[model samples]
Target chain A: MARTGQVKKVGTALAGVLTISLIAGVVFGEGTSPAAPAAPIPPVVAPAPFSPECQGGSTEIVTESPLPHVAAALMKRRTVRILAIGNSTGRRQGGFTRQIERLLKQVVKGADVVIINRGVSGELAANASLRIKNEVAMSNPDLVIWQVGTDDALAFVPLDEVRETVESTVRWLKEHNVDVVLAGLQYVERVAQDDNYYRTREMLRDVAAKEHVMIIRRYEAMQFIAAAQDAGGGYGPDEFERTEAGYNCLAQYLASAITVGAFGKGMSARPLRGPPGSQPQQPPQQAQPPQQQRPMQ
Target chain B: MPRQSNAIDFWRGIALITIFINHVPGIYYARFTHANYSLSDSADLFVFLAGWSLRYIVGVPDRPQQPIGYLVLRLGGRAVELYAAQILITMIAIAMLAATATILDNPLLLEWHNAAAVFYDPIFTHIGLAALTHHLGYFDILPLYVVLMAVAPVFAVIDRYAPNWLLPISIAIYLITLIVPLPIPTWPVEGQWFFNPLAWQLVFVLGFVMAREDGIGGFVRRHITVLRWLSVPIVAVSAYIVWNRMWPDPTLMPQPRLLFIADKTYVTPMRLIQFLALVALFSATYPYIKRWALRLVEFGSMLGRNSLIVFCVGSILSLAGQITRFVYRGDILVDTVVVVLGVAIMAFAAWLPEWREQVRLRRSAQPLPAS
Candidate 1:
């Protein structure tokens, strides 16, 4: 009797387990082989004309090689998805994320850029690192543009941990056949002198060099623009309202890099501001190429 | 302090402290919290302990003397109180963020945690916020707690009348909800609630059911020694999995990914299992708690005892901590001072209830004739 009761209990438990499995099989089995995607339709708006402001200056922020997947999609389907994450993407209204999309449509031929901005403001790198895999798996984007390092710098996350986390995350993206672009360290004036800010910016540059992934010099780009705009400038608040102009400028810069990097060749680093503290000697700027007209808004 | 550990209060206190640190997103000490090694953090402990407390207060389902209607009213009232508390905190958080932005001369602070809603679409977002569908970051958990509270009476009745069937039904609902998603969608945003009450109800129900001395609870008590030994390996492996970032990608998993992966939002199976194993190991440590540890536990107990109020104050304190960090251009010294002071305030908040009771007693003795 005792043996029979024990058998009965085990059998009951197995049935419950089996039931859960059977239901799961029905749910996932149907979802696994997704239907074939519809043929791509060309976007409604015309691609924006290229802006001279984006022509080239900082070769450091430009992509080194072609984004193979994006390039292929551009050639065949004319459709490409980009996931923009990290803290600064949606900080401003009419965010830079949308600006990047608008610019890409305006510039790239036979290209449709759909950007899904999952930027949670004030989120640290450690938290973002954990969420990125899921975001990528769900969307399967061709490129991930992460505006990183700002929150990590503010949070006092150890430099080593920040580098390790970013490297591992970038590695994970690569393994999963997604290209990553690291947009580093928003140039905030308050923390400009803080070691954490400067160290984190340097660490990202080093990570980019070692990992060989493209790292957008958002900090450098902003600093250079502010410096050029101000006769004597070095990372403090410039005469320009930082948020509105900064978002647009960063978008324009990234858009230009993506266009050239996807279709043409990598940009050469034009030295600017001469390594931070040195007296400004009119550091070579990306002067007008003459063929280009008004800068794309 | 010298007696057997009050496991619930001790753990609740621990959860409170951890929650405070975690809420201040960029604090240096936050990295050391339980989330570093485990899939679930203090939130899970908090909700679970809430369920346990309700059961502890109401007595076992089998021998309840109070009418079911009264029990329903009490729990429903608790839900109302929590709703009020949630709204109070949300409004305060918005004001705090707004003031921070003005004081710091950085309008960007208003953009943090979706506070732009207050400036742009306050009416629509406030509707959602009041309805408990929209939650700001660091101010989310209370709404989830309120939703859970609203359903406490049903849990009580089921646990009492059909104790054996209670867990099975709750688990079945949870499993189904995980696949189908919640019936109601969040507003001012087109996604589900961050802490979906449907899925999270399982842990809450689990805590309630397990707190009893009969049914599955009795079986666990009988086999606790064996279970504790088994849990050691489970906790150890789970810790390794999270600490090493060895999580399997949930998207790569089959349907019912909630069961296969570790996620915080839905309280997925992996997270639930890992949390349970950790609890199993720690629950047995009451007797093993040293005298020195008890005093610390006692402080935590004070906070835990008056959790609702302390938690309210703690939430505000967390936002304050964030603003202070931003303002101070934080370093180790700043982070240390804020964390130490923040915890000290929460402790004082916790002690106030008992302090009030003692004052009431003394007043009653001296002032009856005058009254």
Candidate 2:
């Protein structure tokens, strides 16, 4: 018994020494380090005014003709900051934000565009809505592009609940004098099957119209692209929306809308793709004079 | 079962509850779980404890006096039950998602968690799911568990005859998988399993090997007090590491980001070490905790006793909570109600088996006057 006790003591001591050394080694070894910086998104060249992807103006500018706040910042400061918040759509794998920045750089001469991503994959808009206020306050971007409703649509969240969350969030953004842009859902083949997908899309459109904020017509443009794709042999057989090409196209559409909205009718006095809900025709022949988009405030 | 009152069951129950909340995306109560404050979360704990539980069934120093074939068969039977459970639960989840999707008129439900592939190509995907090549989101861990249990007997036999080489061999396979980065691939989506068994088996082996009282488990048990002291700083530093998102960035680390990154799929070394340190510390303090705390052991013990059943129900209930949060606006009150009701239901599910056992004991205690 005495020998056993002595052996146990020896074992305990050896174990203690070993553990202490292990802990010390780990504690000192590779101590806390920071997350690697986000990949540098190279600013590339701008797309043509009417790429196959751009339809009229993919986004209908909601704030009055001149985006005075963004314009003022761009013209005087030659710098504009945009906060892109959403789910997987906002943080596309191909660096959609980089494409947007490059296009905006082309649109605004000698101007610097800083776009920040505030997206979490698989995050619901309801959750995003709760967190947006803090993000906006921290980043204080000139414009906030909120990609919403896709996850909610997928999660089986109620339509009214979706509307209420969005409508109220938009109201808060507007009240804070943050120019809000509601980017709609991604269009996919499955979307055709889901009634709530379009229901959520329409609700966003209605909210944008009601609040008088700009919204990128992402779903409609993607639908147009998907239809064009079905006509055969454009961008391979992959789901157009899931592909990198789809995200780049989206970036082009959104960038074009922002440029048109920011610079006013003077630069491109071009005709839009079509008037809101007009005949399904091609781009207007002449660059008609656009609204004198000064800020409503 | 001399009315076992170990901390394993209690911690496992906690892991179960935490997993249930975290599985439900966008739940208000999720942030309160261990993941926010640690590199490893409840999943790590659950898997580790799972491996530890295997030792109780069959391992050196305390293995049951059963024939090797019987042991193999017993483990095989468990694997079969788990496989069946996986299929049944997966189908139930599908039905639930389908019902919600149809009610809300959203086919997008099929898209989340790669379920869209199943719906889009049901015949093939169903075949894949049955064959254990495909797994659904939030319903994945069980498939991994099934694989581990199936593999346990081989390790158990090796453990009985050649314990020294068991862990080395297991670690070698783990490291090889990491180096080659081999993972069991999933179908229809063209991705690998979320919890890669190749990588996770390391934790399982470590847990099992460390549980044997004649080996490291004995050493640790003997030196638990000193190790517990060492764990204080380990836990403190780990908390800071997690909160600050501090770790050697995976990209900066040498080859194989799987080994370097803080990932759930691979259970990276950083997460593994921290979790081990945590278990070492926490397990040592279990006895003292009971002196000062609530009936932490009793409720969790009951739930832990029937962990598998409770887990299945808990997972289903968690989905229901998410749907509830969606259907009704998510707020403090709504979140509170969901969590409260969810826990209550889990408790009832856990308590049912225990209640039945207690009633049997009471009846058994009654002297059979004529027997």
Candidate 3:
């Protein structure tokens, strides 16, 4: 009996030691080092329009044209088009697509900014590829703003699949001469308490870089707004509205910049400046002759 | 035999009730639901109890073949019943999805149909393939239980003949699972299954081994005295550990590498200790709780005796509650009220058949006494 009791005590002690050591080893091991104060994440910055002369191409100005004369000619010749494709969040009436469309209409006015919103909610990038040709390519879009990766993240899509799908989609779009603007995923702080969303966003950024496509940096913008709201106090109905508005502003900023970059002097003359208080004012809007707006067929 | 005053059923009922509430999303308390106390955990607890009860129902040493066969048949029948229940629930879920998609003008089905290729990938094709080798979802526990039961006979033999070896074997299995890497491909990702059957088997087998102890009653009596004193400190320590583990200083994030062990997968050594400590702490106090639990268990056992009927009815009621929540969107108060009423109706349904049988038995036995 004494020997048995001693053995039990020894087993208990050994269990305790083993458990403690294992925990210590893990807690003290590689990942646990105090994350070096993350280099302060740079705030998202809108791209500035380049001067027409700096574009390394011939510049032409058509006067009293219903569209930016240069862009009007390009549109008549069927040159520049843009497509927005994503899930339901992208398709909402007041969602990213509408905001981008409104911004394009305002900025490029008569430049024939054909913005198509082909967003189906809950659809991952994998499915988007299936219908890409008919829905996106048929328009012969010169630029495609891709807002995906959220549904894929929520659905537990493997990181590699996410990378491969985005890569293949980018390759396909580029092959068809469509300039790709990979829209980074919005932050899902609530569901992503486990850091899954952050990981997905990082992967998306990596894909954008690897594919050599422009990135809209929506993830950073959303995180910025979310953090600002949190700092100001707490979440409320108004705050949610403000966050949505901020996301819209982000979409507008990215679309306008990419459009200006792609079409150059052919881009419309509307002010690139957002509504008052939308973002930190950076540069003065360049002046151009007003052009009449025409309804898109 | 009269229903034993086993608190096991009460605990089971509580587990089920908690799980029912946890599944009802958008509740005020929804955010607080953790892996330890959710449906998967409840299933784990149920399996452990099933193993324990198997030993209890069959004699410890060598039981008669007839009784053994009866027990096996009962358990197997229960498993079959569960499978049928799962199939029914799946159909109901599909119907609910359809209705919600149509009435809410939601594009959920359209989206699902469009993404069928991604959604319909075989379980093994995904990460943690071993984990997803079984169906992927919150409702896959029944299949796991069925698989576990097929091996229960082997476990029964060990329980009956080599009881002392059970703990060592279970410990060895758990340690191996901890030390060795088993990457089970799961849909969308590769990781271990939620329950980590290898690690969890220890608890089930421990329960089985405990049920066979000859001096359980005496042990309870003695432990009850010590438990009253020890429980306070144990609880305090447990609480402390939980707080420290979950809410460690934000500064610790920089050293995320160091916190790799904090991950719950693989039953990390700390988590194993914490969970075992909780179980031991709770078990030690059982004697004091037994008096009240005994009576409740009698009530619960009466319901649990026909658990299949109760489980099926309970699941349907729970589904109705979920559908109601999905339609209503936000009204947490209404959701809670409806769920509570639904649970009551299920309990009553579970009770009626057993009550009627009891009455019939009493009447039949009375006539024999008069004769």
Top candidate on DockQ is 1
Over 4 Å off, model 3:
A1-297, B1-5, B29-44, B62-78, B109-136, B183-192, B215-234, B241-269, B280-309, B315-319, B359-371
lDDT of 3 by residue, B83-104 (tens): 6665665455545555655665
Cα lDDT, model 1, residue A221: 53
Sorted by TM-score (best first), the order is 1, 2, 3
Task: Point out the worst 10-residue segment of candidate 2 chain A by lDDT.
Answer: A1-10
Candidate maximizing lDDT: 1
Please give, for residues B264-313, the per-residue lDDT of candidate 1 as tens digits. 76788878988887888888876566355778877877888888988998
Query: B193, model 3: CA deviation in Å?
Result: 2.4
**Tens-digit per-residue lDDT, A215-273, candidate 2:** 76667665555555565424354552334445666687566556544533222233344
Error of 2 at A251 (Å): 13
lDDT of 2 at B174: 83
**Model 2 spans with C-alpha error above 4 angstroms:** A1-149, A152-297, B61-64, B358-371
Candidate 2's error at A283, in angstroms? 13
> What's the lDDT for candidate 1?
0.68
- Better structure of 1 and 3 per TM-score: 1
Q: Per-residue lDDT for A60-160 in model 1, tens only? A: 44434445566556656787788887774653333677778777776554567887666665677877887677667556688888988877776667789
DockQ measured for candidate 2: 0.04
